[model samples]
Target chain A: MRRVLVIEDDPKDMAITRNAVLRAGLFPDCVATGEEALSYLLRNDCAYILVEPCVKGLNLPLILSLANKRDRKAAIVVITKDSSLTSERKLREMGILYYMVKPADDMELSMVLQNGKAD
Target chain B: MEKPISILLVDDEADFRAIISDHLEEKGYQVFSVGSGQEAISAAQEQDFDVALLDVKMPGMDGVNLLQMLKEIDPSVEVIMLTGHATIETAVQSIKLGALDYLSKPVRLSELEVTIARALEVRHLRRQAFQLRERLRQKEAFPEIIGKSRKILAIQQQIEQVAQTDATVLIEGESGSGKELVAKAIHRRSKRGDGPFIVLNCGALQESLLENELFGHEKGAFTGASTEKRGLVEVADGGTLFVDEVAEMSLACQTRFLRILEAGDYRRLGSTKDLKVDLRIIAATNKKLAERAKQGQFREDLFYRLNVFRIVVPPLRERKEDIPILIGHFLANSEVGPKPPPPVSPEALESLMDYSWPGNVREVANVVERTLIVSQGLPIRPQHLNLTSREVPLVTCGEKDLLPLEQVERDHIQKVLAAVSGNKRRAARILGISLRNLYRKLEHYGLANSEPLKTAL
Candidate 1:
């Protein structure tokens, strides 16, 4: 089974994302803060990393760089409330697999993670 | 026939209450003055009041408490609090308890009247917004045609204009291009909107079956005719009867339909009595109906009668700009997926725009629904769309080279004129321009004779 690292500060959103990942036949390693997410990435190997950009203590670009160094194959998916195209381009340039705005359908996230990449 | 605005005045002082009540009555208001909060509650229980005035300092059940109680009784009642010993705390408390407004004691009669007027205006606006929301919610009650293109705007205008009369309407469009939606719009807007709107597809049944289904059969009229049946015409008596694919109606059936169009009367098969019904007929066809009528395939007289009001629904490809809006609407309203269907990716939207939807708006709905299921819990991408690589033709101009702007306009006007058989008025309507403007263009292009017709104004 694949392992998914779920990083969400919101308790409700984290629970929903964990459930979706578990339902997609993947084990979820959950964290509430960006510092915890960075430490978890350093100590563990996971197939996918799900994140929210607005989490406390989040350095999204640095987190993306660390994830890339730790596991070059990890597919980083950013779910954020900022729907600006500038942010999307910056995230995409950092090699994130997908950028979903807030109110992102949980079911789609499960499918995207299950399939590895949306392409 | 308008009812007077009713106001309930509650003030402990008898002399003050009487003076205010008399002044309100002189201004043509039905004023009900009560000496105590209990009496005001009793009066409210007996009948409804549009507005209520409560004194903040009262003997029992003060104004703030009474405001809460009155709101509980009828949330629609507008309550204004009056205080002789005015304080910010009591004013804030009164408003927090749902008081519409608060005023200090010794308020001028004119000032009080202005407050009442403002309260009534607010209530009126709130009711209007609620009614508008309710009407929008009823979108599910009828087929909603959604598009913002000039072609669609013109069609909507035509529906509104034709809905005011009982004229027979002919809607011409390609297959799957929302002709039924236009018919329903006309019916829903007409005076007969409250009445039943029935539909019958002319192309669905064979000639004999179609006539039997339309006119219905009397008992013993045929071998399987065990009982008399009411036709769609009778069911739609007070409203509208929409006939779809009417060009496919057989010649024999056309003759029978012509009778109803000419005189609102039709007899059941094997029944001698003529049955009359009052109904408006709106017919739709995907075929070139005027040409078909001239070719002796359809009844020319029936064609002329049904063409009293003509509405042309443009094909989806012409309104491609509305594709994103339509897709969003379909995805949001779709029941296929769980609540909140996944969004479409930008690449997927571009692919959708590239394809020529030969089946028109209906095809877009089907594609969206199918993609929702296949994509599951993920944003829809081009792979989920599964469309073949077929790009829509940009233009169908005869020459590969681009024509000048004036020439393109002239050519389009000439083609539309020929399609409508040189009816300038109908051409102008289809072109979405004023009749005078169309005439000027025609003269500028030298398409029409210099000698204008008498009705050319």
Candidate 2:
């Protein structure tokens, strides 16, 4: 199975994301902070990186740059509770393939991850 | 037609239900008022409701229980709880139980309208999301089949079943019923999906041109043959060749094509050597090829060879349930002018639904395009359609408007000829008359100097 890295600070959201990723036929490696995510990326290569923009100790730009540099084939996905258009624009500018809001049904989230498109 | 928003109002108070129903009906919403929960469930089972207002304090099957049941029946229907007494616990519980909103009894009319509007908006967004997901899932395979009716679903299943094999497929349907789309879907799902898909319309050319196009001539084979050209059959090697209007093939071309179908090889017009090719054949016809074969018009052997598998696409009139969905799809995707086309009124939709679409799906698309131009960003009404009669009537009963039968016939002939850009063959076909007969009529009518009019029925 393909591997996906999920960075989420909240326990409830982490569990939901982990289950959704598993349901999409991918292995999920969960981390609570950007630092851990960066370390994990340095040590391993994954097909996708699903991250929450407000994760603890988050440095979105640095982490995205490093993630792209290390795993050139990995696709970045942003899942957050914030539905603000500005945040979506910034994440889009950072070049993410998927952006999903919170409370998205598991089926929809899994579909997005498998299809690699937010819509 | 834009469907009216339907609401299900369940309250024991007859006066309240009547007043609310009147208000909603005034706003052009279809309201189904029920005095008890059982009636509401029965109503829900009968037809789809966009929103439901349930009274929390009902005699039996209270609001919360009814909410769960309704959600079970159709999860997409938005529900709101209405109670005389409001409590924090009940409100939170109602929200948790999937009620979109909770309203206290004797609610202000303005507030109720606002809440109902919000619920409708949410329902719309949810529906859009569901449709998007469905399209995305099938985007790689056959996204062209847009209808969800039973007939369309059956056709989709047939496409999936036939696409797994390399057997020859014969698709039969009315004109403009999307036979080519089904053929392409089969090719896309086949093992040779990476290979090219070539299409040739047999009715669009003469016998000689069709044969030459299918099987090219060698260099110096003919007076105008300057270079050796590869035929469509050769180009479609390792792929699929879709032959549209195959019933129109002449006897000579049919004989040559039968040779290829039987032997898997064919010789060019001027070449003695037989060229072998590995290609799947998919043929489509709007006419009954079997009847043609029985009448000695179409080759029987070729018909049987191409009929290894058959998919019959029903006409638009047979599946009227899909009309609304097709209209939505066309309106959303058409690039005639601005970002969005004007909304279609209910009366116009009813008119469209009642009319018999003689030209099938293509006619629907043509009507939509024409209305987009005519409406000019305003709400589309029945007058904007201008359907059935594409031109002014030439034989009205009024004395000044009435014309002689010969005059009317002559004018109509000229109009049809102009519509088809003076293509006499097509004009004859559209006029349902023979080419020779049409020529004699044109000569007798003296229609040599008539100007072309860009209109067609």
Candidate 3:
């Protein structure tokens, strides 16, 4: 019954992500854009935040700034369509633990479910 | 077939290798003899040797060099240096490089044998220490008993005090009040900390099975005993044996247990060979053992014997101050997952603190897990706990509800069957009785004929 935040642009990708979250026994709160995701964070607390880096107008800095607040902080995981090493390094530097390329498997999702505990 | 204690004799001279391996083999050893250091290293890779005899003067690699490489290959193997040129400096260097001892090449056979025996003994102790260290490095499967309340502090003091002696300890507490945890603390602090800690739930097994589990059986001792078996008593030699629900121990099993307590000797179920084991007994029960003894339900003498050091663990409701700390611990340790943040809302915390924990710490833990799973990453509200089940659930009927022995047995079997959804195997395991006994019970109750065997989840 734990809640997870899913930020995805495509409906199909969002559906897959929501199903995986539900299968992990968590409620997924999906938003298509970073703006909506940030507003959702303003009202609700999540255990994990799943973000797609390639989403349109996905403001990483603003998302990070909002999530950096102590009470609202959640473990951020990057599921990106881009497999650039530079992007992965940037995500790692920003303290995202797992960076899954496009088509992330269930095992990867299960690992995120098991290991995600924001400090 | 598994080979016996093995020795590797490495030397430049083939004659020395042949002589040593033959002599060792004659003395009941599995010997692997090689000419040079390289061969020795490769041979070592294939199998482990208990002891190694190295000649200091080798053609390609010297004995000291081989000793270092061998140490890397299998750190457990003990090495002894054999040299015709015995310089004090070289001997010291060999010892420094991890040789067990250095001996001159003109060593006597008896002296060589004695050195090998000493090496084996040292190797055995080291191996035991290695295994103990590995086990110590891992956390115990059960959670540590956590509390800083006065009652828990007194219990901790009692554990420390009683741990100094090997006296029988009787821990009295409500179910899930952490009797087993207290027992573990005692054993860990006792002189027998390094030895095994064996636990048995007396309530989970029948009289005959309980006796067999504790005392073991010799092959052909009973119809299906098959091979000789070592029981918990033997396994707990020089350790601690914790008997939970000791009040549930049947009179017949109690009599057998009494003999072991008094004489410190027991025969395997089917054999007459007297076996002796040194162990500390720690018995625990949720029932009033003295009252049971007064009612003739438990043996008076056994009760007195186990009451040498009595420690009562208070129920969780009595020590409400510990509830918050316990909740935090359970949240952090939900599973093999990451430590979850303790995000219980104030109202939820107040509700938890106010509730009467009839099932004590165990019930609180279950609630913590269930609520955490439901709440996910959000702050847990009061409603998330779903605490409608207010009363302590009974595993068996209360004393007032006791039926005839036959009816009680039938009812218990029926309950177990229903729990497993008619799966006989799992029910047998839960009942601590064999499948044969279950079938017999079923027939006696006339249920086997009425209800056919069905596979169930």
CAPRI quality level assigned to candidate 2 from its DockQ score: incorrect
> Candidate 2: which pairs clash?
none
Error of 3 at B144 (Å): 2.4
Residue pairs in collision within model 3? A2-B376
Which regions of candidate 1 fall more than 4 Å away from where they truly are? A1-119, B1-143, B392-457
- Candidate 2 ranges with C-alpha deviation above 4 Å: A1-119, B1-141, B389-457
In terms of docking quality, how is candidate 3 classified?
Answer: incorrect
lDDT of 3 by residue, B1-457 (tens): 7669889999989887888888889999988888999999999999888999999998999998999999999888999999999999999998888889988978788999999999999998998998898786564422366888888878878888998898999999999999988998899888998877777777654566567667867766766444555566776678888898999999878887877788778877888778888989999999999999999999999999899999999999899999998988888877622355648899898888878888888888778767877777678898888875534433786788767999888777877777777889999999999999889989889878564434344
Supply candidate 2's per-residue lDDT for B77. 95
- Mind giving the per-residue lDDT tens digits that candidate 1 earns over B1-457? 8889999999999988988899999999999999889999999999999899999889988888888889888888888988889999988888888888888878789999999998888878888898998987786433477877888778878887899899999999998899988998899889988876777777654566567657866766765444564566766778888898899899988998999999999998889999998999999999999999899998999999999999989998899988897898888887677677887888898899989888888878878878888998698899999764567556656666877999989888887877776888998999999999998999898977733323312
lDDT of 2 by residue, B400-421 (tens): 8778899889878878888888
Window of ten residues with lowest summed lDDT in model 3 chain B: B136-145
Against the true two-chain complex, what DockQ does each candidate achieve?
A: 0.01, 0.02, 0.01
Scored on chain A only, each candidate's TM-score is 0.90, 0.90, 0.91
Docking class of 1: incorrect
Alpha-carbon error at B115 in model 3, in Å? Answer: 32
Q: Tell me how far the alpha carbon of residue B172 in candidate 2 is from the true structure, in angstroms, after superposition.
A: 0.7
